[model samples]
Target: MENIIKVKNLTFEYTSDEHTHRAIDDFNLNINEGEFVAIIGHNGSGKSTLSKNLNAILIPTQGDIVIDGMNTKEEKYLWDIRQTAGMVFQNPDNQIVATIVEEDVAFGCENLGVEPLEIRERVDSALKNVGMYELRERPPHLLSGGQKQRVAIAGIIAMRPKCIIFDEATAMLDPSGRQEVMNTIKRLNKEYNITVLMITHFMEEAVEADRVIVMEKGKKILEGKPREVFSHIDELKKIGLDVPYMTELSQLLNKDGIKIRTDILTVDEMVGELCQLK
Candidate 1:
């Protein structure tokens, strides 16, 4: 699998007159094309800082960040890098530029100088992709939280980015909105072959990812398949991270001497494990 994004010894620091604060320290990661990776960490864990560096929103203080072979540090490749790795931030309102839903979705391609006809087609497709086609003509401000976030996603996909980095995109959404965005993200990866790097606090969301990376104090502390990483209940708790709900329940079951799998991530998995005991 080709590497869509690669970070080597990436370090980012905020320097001030009094003190310098390191937000990212010696981070290394490679996300392959079409892979869905979820990054989980508490506040001040450097996940958001890492996402910004991926698209050149911030330059690395001490290392390299390559997106689809283009170095983010290069001024000439800034646009190319952004087009290759689009970002959806935590707030949808901040991302939406146009008044109407369809226009907001087409805003990216418009800025890219895509042909009028092509932009129209891309707008339609992007809206449909995120399940917001019917609301294309509606005012963005009139939409719900989830609807607005979907529009934000639609704008990114309209540019036809190879990879999308979601920086806590679901944080401001309600449960239904989060589910809507998550479903769209999954479909984009599984059906459209677009790579997804989602930085989120939701353990259940991380469970669906191909791999989960845990960050702590500006460093990569753990990385593995979701089941493998989340199974370390004590270690994750030490860092103020929670495992998936089912994993937590399984831990309690095992603590009481019930022979159940601690790696259980979903309700179905737990039900199947318990059924075997019957």
Candidate 2:
């Protein structure tokens, strides 16, 4: 797969009179085209900061970040990088600018100067993609948390970005709402082939990813397939991160000398392991 994003020796710092706070320190990463990667970390782990830099919302202090071969630091590539890697923030209210759902979805395309006719098509298609087309005329503020988030995603899709960086997009949503958003994300990656870089605190949400990256103190501490990374129950716990529930159950079974696989990440996998004992 082609590399859609590359981060080399990246460092980001916030300086004040009191002291300098480094949000990202010497972080290095690469994301392949059409890949679904979830990043997990506790507060102040630099995950959110890294996502901001990917879309050129925050410029790097020392290193370079290239998205789709466009360096984020270059002034000329700013809009291009942002267009290529759209962002969906934690709060849907913050992302929704227009009063109506369809208008909100078209906002990004309008900013891009897309033709009115094309914008209409994009808005309809994007809304349908996120399953929000039926409520096109509804006011955003009246929608449920999940519905609002879907509208926010449609807005990003209208921009036609190759990748979407979701910085805790589901954090404020209820479980049902989170599932709705997660399903939309999966469809976007699997059907539309959009690369997905999700920065989230939910361990269950991360389990569906193709790969998981663990961050701590502004550095990459672990990166691997979901099963492989979640297998490190102890290491993740040490950093105040939790593994998927199934993985935890498998680990407990192993600790009790039951001797099952430690990498089980889903309920189906646990059932399979238990059945294998017969």
Candidate 3:
């Protein structure tokens, strides 16, 4: 797989009157094209800061980040870089600018000078892609949390970004709302073949990813397949992160000689394990 994004010795810090706060240090990473990657860490672990720097929302104090061969620091390519790697933030209300859902979805393409007909087609296609086409004409403020987030995603999709970076976009949503957003992202990757870089606190969400990157105190402490990474139950706990619920249950069952796979993630997997035991 080709590399869609790369970070080399990335470091970022903020200067305060008392002292400098290191947000990221010597962090290096590579994301393959069309891969669904979940970045999990506790707040202030540098994941947020790193996501910002990916498309030049924040510049690194040291090191370089390149997206599709263009350096993020290049002033001329900033908009191009962002178009290639679109970002969806947490607040759905703040992201919905236009009153109508369809218009808001078309907003990005409008700014990009897409032809009117092309913009309309893009809007409809994007809404359909996120299963929000049914309510395309509805007012965004009236939508549910999950619906609003889906609208936000449709808006990004209209921009035709090769990769989408979601920065805790589902954090404030309820479980069902979170599942709605997660399913949208997973489908976008599995069906549409878009690269996904999701920064999330949800361990269950990470389990569906092609790979998981664990961050701690401004650095990359662990990176591996979901099964491989979640297997480090002790390390994850030490970093103030939780293992997936099924993984935890599987671990306890194993300890009690119930004999279950330690890497179990989904509810269906747990159900299968229990049935087999019976």
Model 3 C-alpha lDDT per residue in residues 100-156, reported as the tens digit of each score: 999999999999999999999999999999999999999998999999999999999
TM-score leaderboard ranking: 1, 3, 2
* TM-scores of all candidate predictions against the true structure: 0.98, 0.97, 0.98
On the 0 to 100 scale, the lDDT of residue 96 in model 3 is: 89
- Model 2 per-residue lDDT tens digits across residues 1-278: 89999999999998999999999999999999999999999999999999999999899999999999999999999988989999999999999999999999999898999999999999999999999999999999999999999999999999999999999999999999999999999999999999999999999999999999999999999999998898788899998998899999987899898988888988999999999984
What is candidate 1's lDDT per residue for 1-278, written digit by digit as tens? Answer: 99999999999999999999999999999999999999999999999999999989999999999999999999999999999999999999999988889888888898899999999999999999999999999999999999999999999999999999999999999999999999999999999999999999999999999999999989999999999999889999999998899999998898899988888999999999999995
TM-score of 3: 0.98
Please give the lDDT score at residue 88 for candidate 2. 94
What is the Å distance of residue 200 in model 3 from its true position? 0.6
lDDT of 2: 0.95
Task: Name the candidate, 1 or 2, with the larger TM-score value.
Answer: 1
